[model samples]
Target chain A: MSLRQILLVLKREYITRIRSKAFILATLLIPLGMVVFFGIVVGISLWDSDTEQTIGIADRTEVLYPRLQEIASERYQNLSDLAEDSLQALVQGEEIDGFIVLEETHIEGQKDPEYISSGSGGLKLQNTLRTDLREVIRNERLARADVSEDVQKIYESDITLTTTKLTESGEETEDDTGFLTIVGFIMGAIIFGAISGYGGLITRSVIEEKTNRIIEVIASSVKPIELLFGKLAGIGALALTQMTFWIASLLGFAAAAGPLAGIFLSEQMSNMPETAQTAQAPQGIDPEMFSIPAIETSLIIYFAIFFILGYLIYASIFAAIGSAVDSEADTQQYVLPVMVPIFVAYIIMFQTMNNPDGTLSVIGSLIPFCTPIVMITRIAITDVPFWQISLSILLMIGTFLGTMWLSAKIYSVGILSYGKSTNWKELMKWVRQG
Target chain B: MAVIEVKNISKSFGDTRAVDNVSFEIPKGRIFGLLGPNGAGKTTAIRIINHILIADSGTVTINGYPVSSKTQSMIGYMPEERGLYKKMRVGEQLIYLAQLKGLSYEESKKKIRYWLDRFEAAAWFDKKVGELSKGMSQKIQFIATIAHNPDIYIFDEPFSGLDPINSEMLKEIVIELRDNGNTILFSTHRMEQVEQMCDDICLFNNGKAVLNGKLREIKQRYGKNTINIEFEGDDAFLDELQDVRINNRSANYAEIRVLNGQSMQEILKKAMNHAEIYKFERVEPSLTEIFISTVGEDNINPKELS
Candidate 1:
């Protein structure tokens, strides 16, 4: 195999593919579009949570009215003067979000207070209303028992558990498992998408060359293995180019997302009441937890290693399938089997992310076909054994090299053959002959 | 000295022998036509010569170099099933194909322009191959085949889809290539084109070379037993003639082959007795008749061969 010829073929494949509109759209526009789409979703959800609901109260007891008003403040409206029919009309007209109907039971807790609305209200609103009502009832009971407000304040004080991890050196570090899980899921999904996308590209290109009959001319000029290697290398470079773009964009987005989220949250804070502002403070994992440290160098390096090997394995199979048949329609027979491993990996991705140490996850991570995706998730969610990672990487490299050799043999013979569809038996025969 | 030499080259695809002990040598600076019925292994032989396929047993050499990638780079091959990338521009495709043949980028570009201009296709440089008519694409394929200036050129069924004008244009270019000391070999079922263009010919039948040699020698060996007659009326005398086979019989003309010690003078006399003979002459057996007679009737049906 001539290096010059291989380089020429590689140059052609890379330049032509990268210049295509589809590659450009997929590599750049799709990611940007996804970010915009997610931003819209997040912004809309924030808007939904920030808007406070106004509740009208019709209390027959007259005792609970002031207490409810004090608890809800500006969000509560007194409707005790309205008749039953008028209250119904107001509810139907949506004059308020919903109205609370309080009935008298001689100040004894005989029945639960009903909060009516057109539909279920937001979880936060329901929780706030329930807690306030429970508190008011408890305080009433507490007064009967002559308990002081200071004791009540002590009972109502919030407690937050700061979970930390103790390292082997006797130092405690903040547990970032939640953040790492999210990072792992994202990385796994990206690797899976890149491999499948680039693998399909290799298949389509091979089919194009075969159907065009240019394969013969090319095969004559260079060794078949050189052609296959050149094609893989060229498209592999394109895949890496797209991956680099995605990673850079992600890092850029990560850097900008903090400030952007700050501005967006501040805007929402200024638009809401002070009480609502406190209720809507960012919850769960801190934004800082999703930092660069979450993506360690080892994970990135292994991710790259597995991604390339995975692509080569699948793309070689795809190319062989491409050569065996005359058209895309004929690809069905071979494509399904090749896709099984990828689909299995994808189906188990979430499982691996959730329980990286589970039996299924461990096995899936070690399997050559699933390692690229599942192993990356495992690495992120938990500390994988070094031997496991190395063994998986080595196995993937071996599998890919073997697959490439076999595919090249099939491809060399298959490209020259036309008209009839070739089956696995024929391909095996070619491999044996080679 | 021969530019390409095939010695007992044989290739088999599974149980079917595509080329059976096929041996032929194309001398330097001559047009060699590989004539055969469909599926008679003409393509397989050409592929082997071009090093697209390896012979199971035997050897093929180009310029005394054993058939390999290196020798392949020196030979221009246009397959019978012609193809070009439809999405690529004409000039770009040519340059790419030329570069693959080992030409440098600048050299490919220069040759591409020269060939495209020679074919009067300068305006089509930027046009996509798919957008061009079939004839136009064929021209591009032809140019791509020769643009690298290889010393040996092989074309399998080169004129299958060409019109008369384009075919003529290609015939001139092929002749010019041979004149420039490039050895040319082409396979075709079109005997007339082979007769007109070829200096020597190999007639393949059933995976074997049934007959082959210089065209003049083969025709001389067959002898001039055929006669060409052009007449206006009374073509019934053609039926009365004994020991003669009539071919391409028309109302005004007929090609008659005499056998069993028959005389052309007697046929001419009989034709003059009934009709006004415009022309009467004895001619050598045509490549078509020679091919038919050599391969025999049973092997001539292309549809059945496949």
Candidate 2:
């Protein structure tokens, strides 16, 4: 129980892991890999923009030629006035994405206009040109009919809607679009999942040591609690260091190449014109309003606390199971029940993303078993009650402590057992025997 | 002074009694052998001593106190099954284990370095336990077991994977530890090793100590009636000897096993009358022979013993 003994184990474990090539490689490569993967995707999408298609346009009216040329040059290369036979050949050829034919005839109130396009390729391009030409003809006819251009300009203006929320304090606030919150929920979910995944790795390590009988030698020198805490602290330190490295590398990459990503996004935004400001507000989510959702801190603390306690709880159980059995293959029977809570937490986290205040999310967050992950996601999207957060933390702590107490009992009994299959029933008996 | 005392300890696995009323005392400054074949509850008893497993009944005392944390700190146990983290560096692992046994880091470092050097494993300081050969790993393990200078040492089959040279090396270390006033428990199936190293032993059979006593005393009690008479004895002089079983006879010498009550002096006198005697001396039974005779004739279930 001595801190010195615990630190000795912790120091040994940390040094070994920090020096391991797998750990070092994983720490550096994960962030780099993510950056490279995203970079390549963005690069390919941007590169696709450079290769413009050659389209043929046949204008029989010549009156529609000006508008056609303007739209064609704006979107693609225009090869106007090709012979009918050449147009047919180009439409059927691989050199162009498509061809368009425009025809017009002067009439009293009905000038029948026909637009022909290739059956395959550049449908949006052809559609854009056709719409522009129709607008040009409409305007020309409107002037002929003595209608003013000012009224037409007013008719063509765009409108947008804004949403507001009535708060509990009788104050009005811009209803933060669920988009950033959704993204936040996703981020929290991912972080939770990633941490749990690695924390599960720590559990496996505990089981491995117990199953391999190395814990016997280790426990001989240090107390079981010391060994348990040392491993958690050691692996926790490693995980934290790697997480810091990953985050720093990501920030560094963003710092170095952020403008490039911004430029590409802005260009894409200009082309669409609709979603231009959507990506902006999200990028600029006010730090004051977007102060890491209180739930994140709670989640991080809860996750840290629960991760160690939960891992110790589960890992202690796992270690006991490992000691009772002869090999890792036999560990699955015990692990399945342990993994159920993690799986439940994952499901609750995902479902609560869209409806953080919903009954299911609220209940899930309160459930001691699901709160570690579910509450974190809930905290990201909506303001969780202080009471609820405190309660969940307390419950999680209690569960962790109870599990650890229960599992340590089994571990002390089971570590020397071998060459036998150990199930829950036998484990219960062993616990009872104690 | 006794270093360890086990009084009427019993342990069971399910319905099978692994150790039934097992009791033995390990005196300080001697190699006390725990002799039994595989599955004879020798390992189970050792585990109880190390506090790795609890006994179902009875008590164990070490150094005038009940075996507890304090006793554990003074004890070093090398389990029959090797228990070392394979991925840990040899030197770091030894120091860590030593520190756990209550050595200061500085002391552990110095002791570990010295022991590793003695075992010729100084080069293995940076190498992981997994990277060492079985024998080398065993040496590192032995170093770890003894690095903290525990007053009581327990080694179970420590020579299993060691070659003759390393085996001899370990035996020397065991002897040295004893000479330094450390109580040592040596458990093995090798009777020759027991004969060479142990001052006292308890041979277990069917979860019970079938034979227990000082080694020299046990050998003496098995009798020294075997006389090797190297002489030109008349053929009729052999017949005159009472209750004598001939062990071997040469052209110039004869060896005979006489009954317990029969005197060797009479046989010497009887042989002298018939021929000139060159040599006549009683021979004692080896530990190996005694062990086989004691357990072999006990009518215990061999399956359970194994």
- The most accurate candidate by lDDT is 1
Report how far off residue A429 is in candidate 2 (Å): 4.1
lDDT score for residue A411 of model 2: 64
Give the per-residue lDDT digits (tens) of candidate 2, residues A1-434. 58987798788778988998988887778767877997999999899867765656566665555655665564434455577667667666765656556554531335544434455446665556557666666655565677677887875678998878675699997666465466446555555555556655655676667655576676566666677667767776776677667655655654556555566655665565456557555453232442322233554564455444444444445555555565667767776776787688778777788788889989988877677677767765677898998888788677768876776677666665655767778788777754
Instruction: Report lDDT (CA) for all predictions.
Output: 0.84, 0.71
Q: Estimate each model's TM-score.
A: 0.84, 0.74
Positional deviation of residue A53's Cα in model 2 after best superposition, in angstroms: 11
Error of model 2, residue B47, in angstroms = 1.0
In candidate 1, what are the lDDT values of residues B1-306, reduced to their tens digit?
A: 989999998888888998999888889999999987788899999888888888999999899999988898899988888888888889888998899988889999999999889878999999989999988888888888888989898988888878898888888988999999999999987777788889999999889998879999999988877898899987888889998877778999998877788977888888889999999888898887787778776767844321
Chain B alone, TM-score, model 1: 0.93
lDDT of 2 at B302: 38
Chain A vs native chain A, TM-score per candidate: 0.78, 0.63
lDDT of 1 by residue, A38-67 (tens): 999999999986788888888887777788
